[model samples]
Target: MELSGKGGGSRERAALGLTFVLRHGRRTGLASAARLLQLFDVKIHHIETRPARMPQNPAEDLEFFVKCEVLDCKVSSLISSLKKVAEDVEGNREGKAPWFPTKIRDLDRCHHLVTKYNPDLDCEHPGYTDPEYRKRRAFIADLAFNFRHGDPLPRVEYTPQEIATWREVYEKLSSLYPTHACKQYLDAFHELEKYCGYQADSIPQLHEVSAFLSERTGFTLRPAAGLLSARDFLAGFAFRVFQSTQYIRHSSSPMHSPEPDCCHELLGHVPMLADKEFALFSQDIGLASLGASDLDIEKLSAVSMHLILLGRYRTNERTNKAYGAGLLSSYGELMYALSNKPEYKPFDPDVMVIQPYQDQNFQQIYFVAEHFEEAKSQFQKYAMKIKKPFPLHYDPFTCTVEVLDSPQKIKKITSHVKEELKSFEKLS
Candidate 1:
């Protein structure tokens, strides 16, 4: 059976009950599952089966539409039962399944921005389609191709020109960090300089920086071909992984980069990732992005962009805080973003999500978080509005994502780990 369009059946659904779309591997006793739901007074509105896209093993995909005119608790129980039935059908499944919102997985199918060839630069930058730029793009794609989870990060040998570009941006941004940057950023920056070879006349490799962040905040960096769609990029944060580029911006525009480069990733973003509070805040935004509708994803991306751009503005009335890597890394844009000209408001997800953004010029509006903890608290509350079915956690040892299928699973894993830690502490 086919479901009706939004306008046709949405009001009816709301008035009569709420409709939930449930999906699982095909031929998993879906008919039996539907009959069981009837025993609980669940109204099975529709059922459909389709081919699984890139299934691990050959199995059809089944979708069920269930309408329930019951209290919220009852609806939740119904969903819990459905999940159990789905799990039971696939008996003795080995290895934990990586679960994410279907919409987020859909993004993986699209090619990255760096792989696409567009000749029109439009003042964003020069030589996007030039021979040199194309060669650089190929180098980035190679790095991305070689990347594998649970393996050591691959190294890239920088050319003389690339090293020079890194030196120029480094020298310029380092001079401004003492006064313009926040305390957390300053601390992390000092650690990076001392331990990771973040200095003028030298380029810090992605592997080195990733190791630094992993040691400090459980965050790791993966090389990207270039800029990823906001959806794709933010999704990485959910797993405590960051998608970074190894290429420097064109030497001609050392102070400005239309797209994120190694300078921005290493200087602007990496330091914040080292701070536990800020890293959690970043992950909160990522969690919100999963399972979001297309319109919601666009809005969330706008907010992500603004946060990265305006994270470190200096205001006379309040304490100076720099949360965005873009603002922290760019000497020119940092000054412009914190200047008196642009409008400033408290960080509101509702307002920032729909606010317009421009890539050609500095943003005219900025969202100011009072502090990292406040930002984390506020963003966590906002993230609850998003409709996601499962909770996700990263396993550093395996370098894999584990989807918590039930509350019991979350408790079992987390509690067991906690008990082990307690035992170790007692023995010590």
Candidate 2:
């Protein structure tokens, strides 16, 4: 849960990158490339890749696409490898065991800790404490379960130790955390993990985890980290009321229904958070949201796009790598992001925050962070712009997308039209 010395030994571990294979033009090296990637523990699961042009734009760059039939075995193996990487990082962090605090009472204490110990970290609390705020939070929380868990289940209880562990992470993370912009993100994990306490069966390894979403809570069954929980909150922002369907689609399925399952949530997003540099980078961006205007929120959405696509865009070896959970879990996305074919732009948080995103398909454009520190410094310099105790604009749709009374037939039709087009495209 609170990995201490992840990426231990600082052997200069690299982020993951896209792996492009010209399925049509160059089959010659495809096998070797795939083999080499396998040697690197990278996976190549897509079986039906092809070069295709954009539907609307005739002149847009062509892209390689795939709809591989992934067996549970292969997926499980991929997950094992990824989990190994994540575990290695976490083990390393624990070895370091940086002096993390156990608890905090308020934002002032939170601030002092951040400035004193983690000046790089940012925190936010989306002023959701008013009655209306409580109602909204409850509504979102309820909807999140509805879509995922399917019933008003009994309250889940946390063990004294598990509760204490979460309290410890929350306290340490909250201290010096700067923006409430990312509160929703953090809360998503907190909320789900709270569900874990009910399902726990006296397992100690699982006990150390405080906030865990059960299989009932609209995700594939797996233990995920808080950051991934936050990313899942965003990906499923609009689908908070229905159960995360277990029926995975085959290559024959009409649309890319890569269910936003626990594998994607935990495997894709959480490891990067294990990286101190990336964790602080995210805190900085989240802090930017506190003072963000509606325009800033809009721009921040673009920033999310930039981060998602960067998981794939391959530039320099460093620039080519990604820590995003989305790319980590999917063979298709992992391949595309590591591939050099896609255009890679310089990482620019501000410009990215303003860039328009296509919610219907994979990103065609991406920005590359110059260095982890560049992202960190960017947040540090702009931390002031991030407002404290930020306010949120309400979207009736965002608030209630999953709760509308609609039959499965109509719901499927509407999802195909609006959500299915968008869901897998955006990686949290």
Candidate 3:
């Protein structure tokens, strides 16, 4: 049987099959390869084409399955022949190019997760499609883009309207803090008020807040472009780095935001980060995110946000504070969550990690912790399940990630640091 003309023939083939996936541009070459298979008495079972999921390049790829009862040696020969055809196709397109069959690797999964969530590095929320919102977003993005990891955080000059928005939220939440917020949050809030400019009529700069957190818990803030993927955002916490937005929420909706704004980040999240136990708990969640699959990262992100927003609290009990920023920052939601409306469940890592997240509106259920220590203990136990091969540490001085891939690497890095410290001590 001679196969020719795109090899578009219908034939009944046997059960034994081998499948090969090739880029769409290789379709003509695939047909030619099919002809070679026919010459070798290998029957072509079927051919399938599907669109590639590449957002930037929305092209299609081809898959071909061939049926044959050939020996192992013959199958190897068949693979080599197809590879040659692919190389020839490439050579014709680009001079002296080499082609090889694609192989799946462990890192492919990680790369896919990043690409899936962050197709465009400059992704903006749909609401920001308006020209005015775009301008605000661009301004924030410029600052974030220029920022380097270890340098001092850039100071942002808030417009009068922005300061007004901050003033409104600060005044309301501050009044409620003494009565409704947890003790730890109130303490941190008072400290911030005194030291970091956490008061009415003035917007506190991120550098001041970052410095405050650094002194207290080694947590520092990095400017964020906008709402980041769960994986990317949580990964920062592992390094004691918080990706924060410099932009305030749209002035029109000061109380509500479809996405995170400066008010939500500064007021809702930063206070908890200032608490040592809560900071550790947050980092533990981030540590588990290392080498986690996309689905697991999504679960982790949801759980982290849930804990932050609708923190664990009991009804009519004012002794234990709600540590979640979502509760501490939002006057309405905080009061609503503490009320007798939402179902309150004990903090269970197993259930909470996989629980579906609802961001469109207030959550119907919340997981409550007895205290930050309890939350931290539970989170540590949950983190043990993560099977990342290498441990990661953030270097404050250099502002880089150190992957302790081997014991030797750890010793080398630490010994160098120890010697440097000794030299400084001698000089002093």
Candidate 4:
């Protein structure tokens, strides 16, 4: 946290500090950035680096923190130039909010975020005892770690056992789609079957499915090693990206998966992504996550229990269906949710946002909305209700979060909205 000066002018020209991570190879970029800062007559007050090592790779990264003071007018130019050189430049929060990604490529900074249940960390994980399964998981994790945005999605050759495991999940969920799945889920599921070759016999490659989605809704898939913490997972939704896992569940547990796998993504989320309205809902959750405080982010990630708003939908007293990816993917939970067993409640954001989630079993209570569009409208209203110091807009094209901090910025967004409305009126 940064301390602000008392007077207005002092505040305007206050010392600006940034903390960023850099690799040994990027030291030249750091030197070039320092020279550029000198051009703005910025005074470098302090500089430091601390080692950040992973258990897997002891030589991972050294986080660099630098504090500088520069004139008000030159701040923008200096920061812009710094952005061009640094991997991620985070502003001091009390003096300035720490940075989130400003573009699609910037997401590389997020690749190494903390996770709750990693294979090496959690001995209770299903694959922990099986050396072969552990090796397979590590192989896939390496693929994801090396992958970048524009690179061709890595293709995994599923072993016979892996495919057979996926087949069981596919057959079980497909059998229930007709009776228990929502209208949106059913429609998209069939299209995925027709176009992406979503079948029980085999696993559809991520590249094939990602391309299919990009054409329809602009939502695309990226490979993930395993279950990401909720903050990291939901963060991807802001950019219309899904961090999906390519590995299948262990063959012994074909009826269930403790973590996200190919089954959860292919059978559950892939179909839902085909629906445009649902795509909007996904980004809404992701957009709210950007620029949020750590406390607020924690609340948004777990409380947003996307399943509460996204998964269950009830059109009328007699009709309830599974629309959320969590519900659609789990056969046991799907049947349990639609049964007369669990407590059903109205979709009240204030109430639902505080509810605790227990991941091991079926949720005891479920929140349902009338349908997707209305649910989205209701959820957006609730998301807007989260009071922040500044508002933000996510540009899907640039994949950046535009902070409405200045009057000019706010007015520009307002003017753009009015122009969009005028275009709509012309259509009418």
Candidate 5:
């Protein structure tokens, strides 16, 4: 028998098969995803189809790998040069473009697919004709339209007070690390609202936000009751909006922080919220994951990284399309993940649940879904298996840590600490 089992048909059906196999359990993640593509006759679409084989002895390649940095340096230099060109082009413009210029033409095509294929439940097929599918189509349309310009990011201009605050923070950070990355942070913050507007009034109510998010993103942390309580969770409050805080990674830092800082959480996850099906699926997973055990939460994290990061990694091999905001923000990560060198495991929910991952590196393994519903159905089918009594929990005593604060400095981080505790306490 073939690894993916015999297969061929429409892309949707093939994607659906992949979805079913991945959801079948954790052990088959790579195989299921691989087979799903094959079944759909898209196996060659993955970069990992013929992955780089690990030498019989890894030590043999150690020297070669070390010297490869020289190649990496050259590649980095080329990327930097291209980025400069992109920046120069963007600077001459007045506003952020609706989407990347290269991506603009596909806006209508994606919209058409969503409109024509918005899945519905009332139809003969449960996954293909559900109202939720229509919503997802709309969400995808928004994402395609929003990011079609060369610089799809919205221009966010901050108030004087905000700019001053950022300047102060930058000065303090710059003192410790004299790097140019901090300057980028300063510039980006000052331009907030210009690229990404903050709407205090437009903020969706917690319930409404939770519902919409749940449907699109598979974050089931809404309705605030039952095994999972929306009122008792943090995502219910923090991840409700489509606009993200303006910031960028410190190119100099070697460590990655997990807090959903405004930059990653907002810019990375919010724009896709505009796509209804995607948004709902994401929301469902987020909500469903609330109040889950640490083990389950980790699994959800694995799944998230697998799907979102993998989609991003495979976005431009001229195959494996991407629809997540996180992938959209970083051009380097986006293209590299999908490049000829990376590994492409099949989409298997079972393997995704148990796959070993190093938080430090961009994910080594990725799962691909045929469409939004295939992704959503996996969550719904495995609802209880992944369900939580509350969002992931940590022992306050151990999970919490102290931060340094100067006498004159205001407590910028404690407020969030209290919110976290309150959420836990309510659950308690």
Candidate 6:
């Protein structure tokens, strides 16, 4: 249970797994890496090289994932040696610890946690000047602010005006789904309508939809008062939890809102989260954030927001479709992203982490992936670049993070993996 070595004192027992990314400028990324490992008492366990391209360099470079064992006392020296040849080094033994949810009830602790991206309505907000609307908004927001994990999800009785707004947005989007939405989204949407009461006449209640989604994807929704801090929102995915807004957007701007409203959450995100790969892609972002530093978190925003912004557009005659919640929620932006007008760039995490985002405008460029699996694979490679000090694993059955910091933890997890492989072998 101890990771106090700092790579000193005892050299006999502790074993560490290390992965480092080589700098692009150094063409000798592979050769130099192997040479560095031999310089220390390091025993290489497993090694892999994946050819990947970055925006800065047009040439392909190798991504080295090295699993190695070093004398407990010499771990630091090995890391230092690797750093001389590698641009960044990641070892699973040490780093910062961030708060994480380990049980279903533990989520209650985050109920009132606000990472406000302007928690209060800005003047530019559509209903900012309407006191009556503000009152209604606050009433719904309170349900989320006061929410506890086990409490019934707050149900809203839509007024005629709210119904009218819902009808307008629903009709517009439903008509386009046949043409613009991905197949997985359409399938999820129909099931939601059939089982969870998704329709034009009334807004679907969070409780029913939450139950429907949880049964399908192990993902459930909790209400959020408004825009959650990127960090808080992203954290939910680690536990298959999604923080959704309960209030509908202002009726005047039913088609567009500067912030996420219930319209966006239910229409844009809910159905998409039901897709298994998309859900896993979302969890990858959360998994990457555990024990991540502030600067690392700031950079993660590039992919986290894109969880709903990712799209797949084929250059061939096949239809281009939108998979992310961000684009699917907006009628106009969805059209723009799938159209021929905007620049299409492959979803490169190294490039996207630095891309700028605006709450008010449509993204000028859309990141394209052939499917969620490709996006998931590429993003995971990018996630390793996140500076989490130790490795983490999420156990869905228990709804907790299993930190692999001690030998006991490592052995316990390896046994689980071995059991999984055994079952898979029989199926195969």
TM-score (all chains, Cα) for each model = 0.68, 0.35, 0.65, 0.80, 0.35, 0.75
lDDT of 6 by residue, 1-428 (tens): 34545644654644565766665634765676776667675787777664432214536455576766776677777777778776547666523355556666766645433323322447777787778788988788777867887888888887899888889999998888888888889999999889888999998888888899889888999988777666677788788889988777788888897778778889998998898877877788877876677678888877666656555644345557887787888888888877779888887878777778766888877778766577778878888777655788888887888778888888999999999999999999
Q: Which has the better TM-score: candidate 3, or candidate 6? A: 6
Model 5 poorest 10 in a row by lDDT: 61-70
Tell me how far the alpha carbon of residue 157 in candidate 1 is from the true structure, in angstroms, after superposition.
2.1
Error of 2 at 317 (Å): 5.4
- For all candidates, the clash counts are 2, 42, 2, 1, 88, 2
lDDT of 5: 0.36
Q: What is the lDDT of residue 19 in candidate 3?
A: 48
Which candidate has the top score in TM-score?
A: 4
Residue 394 in model 6: shift from native, Å?
1.4
Cα deviation at 220, candidate 1, in Å, is: 1.4
What are the Cα lDDT values of the candidates? 0.67, 0.35, 0.65, 0.75, 0.36, 0.75
Which parts of model 6 have CA positions greater than 4 angstroms off?
1-95, 111-121, 313-317
**Distance from true position, residue 175, model 3, in Å?**
1.9
Error of 3 at 329 (Å): 2.4
Model 4 misplacement above 4 A: 1-96, 112-114, 306-310
lDDT of 5 by residue, 283-353 (tens): 45544554455566566666765654344212223355555434433444445555545677666677777
Worst 10-residue lDDT window for candidate 1 reads 88-97
Cα lDDT of model 2 by residue, 1-428, tens digit: 22227533222322222213232323343443344346544333344322321123323222332222222223334434434332111111111211111111111111110111111221222221234433332343333322212223223243454344334323433332122112223444344345433222221222222123222232122221112222232223222211121111222221222234323333334434434344445544543443334454555556654563243223344435554544454545445655666667776666665666643355666566665556556545544554433222223332321222246645665666687568767855
Clashes of 2: 42
RMSD of each: 10.5, 25.2, 11.1, 6.1, 25.7, 15.4
lDDT of 4 by residue, 70-90 (tens): 767556666677777655566
Candidate 1 to truth, TM: 0.68
lDDT of 6: 0.75
Candidate 1 lDDT at 224 equals 77
**Deviation in angstroms for 404 in model 1?**
4.6
